[model samples]
Target chain A: MIPLSDVTPSALNNVTTQFILLHMARANKEPGLGAATCLALVADETAAVHFQFWGSECDSFRPGDIIRLTNGIFSYSGNRNALVLRAGKRGRIEKVGEFTMNYVETPNISEIKWVPEGASGRYVPESVVSPYSRIFPPLR
Target chain B: MAENLLRPQPYLAENPLERTLRESFDTNRRILDPPFPLSIPTPEEYLCLTRAILYSILTEGRTRGIRLKYLHAIVVDGYASFTALTASVVDELFERLLDDAKEQIVWIAGEMVEVGAQGFGDLLVSLLRQVVGGDYGDGNMWLCFEEASLFLRKWSALLEEDGEGRSALCCGFYCFLRLLGDHCRTRWSGDERLSALRQLEIDFCTKMLKEQFSLCMNVGRDLIRMLQDLVHVPEFHEIWKDLVLNPGAFGCPLFSDISQIYRIRTPSRYFLLRLTPEMERQMRFLLTNLKLGGQKRHQAWFWNKFLGTNPERETLVIDLIRFVCCAHHPTKEVLHSDIIPRWAVIGWLLKCCRKNYVEANAKLALFYDWLFFDERVDKVMNIEPALLLMVCSLPQYVAITDSLLEFLLLLVDNYDVDRMALITRGVLTSFDVLTRSGVVPSSDALTSAEGISPPLKERLGALLLRKEDHSAEAHAID
Candidate 1:
């Protein structure tokens, strides 16, 4: 089992690896049953699958935490990419000590960007380029 | 580790989730980049959207404004939407924000009054049709009626000077009156709460009619003429009676004039009795001008000729009463009760029954015969619950259990036992205590003569005890 951080997206393209991360995702209790944690994660470079942990595994993981996994199987469940890890493979999993979750945070245009001194536009001139430019760079 | 980790090198990822998110961002970018597209909408466009939402809500359709609480929030926060605010939301917001400030209410009132009568009239007519035609349930009907009534009331007050406004107001008032009449005739039945609401409607119509009498009389004569066609409708009779009897409630002088006009032209004795003093004077004045003799002579002649000798007029009054009171056709014995005269009881029962049913007419005739003729007649005999039975049934009567009870009691008294078992079971279900007492007179008399009295009471008592036990068990479980 390769460590998740060491497994690059390209290497994950068609290869299966066991990964355990604190599978941080929205958790909801199933009707008349135990809690479930839903995690959206990439299994390989070409595909991403969501993994759901039920019962004890759901309780064992915390969001925004890292755990290592061994023998995690990959499959697509409905529209989501998924990983399934069983208790027999629990010993292979380890919580990584250092990991930081990444969130997309766009700066407020009015606050972060400065327009040229002589700029004239309908909106208050901010140095920040349009969010569109950041989303889709010029073809060149 | 600290410097490199804190200032991590940027990495690029190509993945489906990231791709979708990236695409979404691209779309937002495209939407925003163009001409820095003006976020501010034109005033006209904004007004149009608000109007659309207002119309949707008013017409009982779904609105985004309601789902999002956009209307309430916008009004509360004083946030200007791209469109003008809907009248309904504005009204609601005003009530909340200004707490019914007289000045704001007046401004709203002015705006409502300015709306074209044609548009307002169409809206009111459509609403009235829905309510009267039973297109909506009671709660929705109440809401629609309330909104239309309040709107018209305010508009009427503010735009009395405008001919179009006055006409629209009258049209709306007429529709409401018709709705009330229909409610009384069809849906209300023995529902006391609804009956009370109908009474309030009557009061409202009376008030509106008084305030807009001339306009109503002018436009209303035509409307009344049309309504006259529905006079045979039970609802029409109910509302018409209220309108006639309580002319002052409408605050309309023209109602009196119209009432007198209806009296002279139609010579309905019911309408004649409902005339106010002013109406009487107006009729006399009109008659005098027409050389039908001076006011007093015409009045005496009118009363003597139409009121005194006109059996048809009397019959009409009796019919109106019969139509109004008896939920079921009154038995002859009930019609003869000393507390109410035979004619009056027959009239009341006629009013109570649905207008178009053949059974209603048949029942009315039966009641008439029972009231006016000797009780010994076969049809009338045994038609009333024995005095003791009636007394025993008084509590149920006051409770207004169901119309079936009244019908059963009347039928049982008349010795119609073909369905006695069914009636007995219904009574048992409705009044456990009374059923257990085993004191239903007609049934008791029949059973006693058959020599099954003691056993019958025991059976009844046992059945009631079992039922009570079951009920207790159910209650405990609940």
Candidate 2:
């Protein structure tokens, strides 16, 4: 059992791990069973993840519930920035002891450093191909 | 110098009214911001101010002309900023001014007619701008149309006398007629007003036909045809048919001549909803004509005249077919039976099936098995029977040979028997071929499937013998 603190939303690869401290919940309708609720969770760190529980299971888990997941699948939802937990069979929910939870403050806007001229941004760097040294072709 | 000194300066008038008017007009040179502070000036005040300015202009007509230009500027600025002079007030001023200067208006119209085609066209456009810009309420706007139409009729009469761009002017005249006709159709009420408007429209259209036979001959033809098609509505059909067929007797074109006629048969919340069933039928007929095999000349003619360039007819056909296929209740039956051909309908459905790839692949497997295995249909179009059979056998192949055996087992346990059977067959067929060719290693397959589905305890008994046999076979081969 991995601790919730150690699992980053960005690095959540195991399908069968419990996720606590979910912040957002939205109600969506599945085709056959009218309305179901989806929960968007992020671990104490800043990385974001989404998990969906449908039909009878949706009624069992609320937004603040501490849920333990079993037998689920991780798939990319839209972009690579987030992963979705889909088709989970078993979820054991435990009541949170306290209503109040401490959250880390986001970094101050003024404190962030700008990149230097040659430094690359967050994406992985690729080697330049010979004829494609420049990112864009010159216009006529 | 003596002549300049002797020139009467109206600003020097001693009367208190004149003095105050001059002072306020001069001081108010700068643009006024609303709330304009001043009380709403009466029509008499406007008239008095206009007269004083005109009097000053006449005294020094040459140099004073330059100063009078500033009056125009001031009026424009005042109109823009003054909230007191509302639409009604502005409308009254225009009506009064036009009433006083009917002769001047006629003179301007005559000038336009004498100045040849381009000049006349420019003048007419300017007049239209002036009319639209005038603050006539929607009702009074129709009143202004009478004067405008009279002036246009007089101007159009000069077409034969002065040989010019008669065709272009005729087209412009036709547009003006349409605008006025639309206005009457929308705004006019009472039997008298309706009859008057209808008569005016008929007269203008007739004049246009007499002047240029092809200005919109087909439009009239279409209207006649539409009226004939509405034979189900006996009263309306008879009224329309009588008016259209006996043009000279009833003073209107035959309904057949009115192509693409949009009659406001019923009033709606926002607009008079235009119903043109005949026009829609004609368009569909034209589209079908273009789609017909061979007769490229007819298709080309239709495309050039009606369809315009690069018409997306193929996509349109596909959409129409899809619409029919997905329609509800009564509409579904009507579309399936009457609207599109069977071959075309099937083609469209196939296109949708291809676009929705996963659904298509699944359905295709089911359809192939159902058709061949159960002998459902005599023949399937476009796809070969042998390929269909091969695709259908995929799930069975996957079950025997794939290393992701646990996933398949889980699928069987979790899903209904029908779904499990379908997916299993698809996966098995693909895996069987791959296994036979030794494309996938037996060990890697087993490792990948582990822990993903079902408890090892539940499946361990059934797989023990096969696992041992595979391992022994591998050792023997190595």
Please tell me which predicted candidate would have the highest TM-score against the true structure: 1
TM-score of chain A of 2: 0.44
Q: Write the per-residue lDDT of candidate 1 for residues B300-362, one digit (tens) a residue.
A: 333343234522223223223222222123345543343233222332233333334323333
Every candidate's lDDT: 0.35, 0.34
Ten-residue stretch with the least lDDT total in model 2 chain A: A131-140
What local lDDT score does residue B204 receive in model 1, on the 0 to 100 scale? 56
Predicted structure 2: lDDT: 0.34
Off by over 4 Å in 1: A1-140, B1-122, B134-136, B148-161, B222-478
**Candidate 1 lDDT for residue B341:** 31
True contacts kept of each: 0.00, 0.00
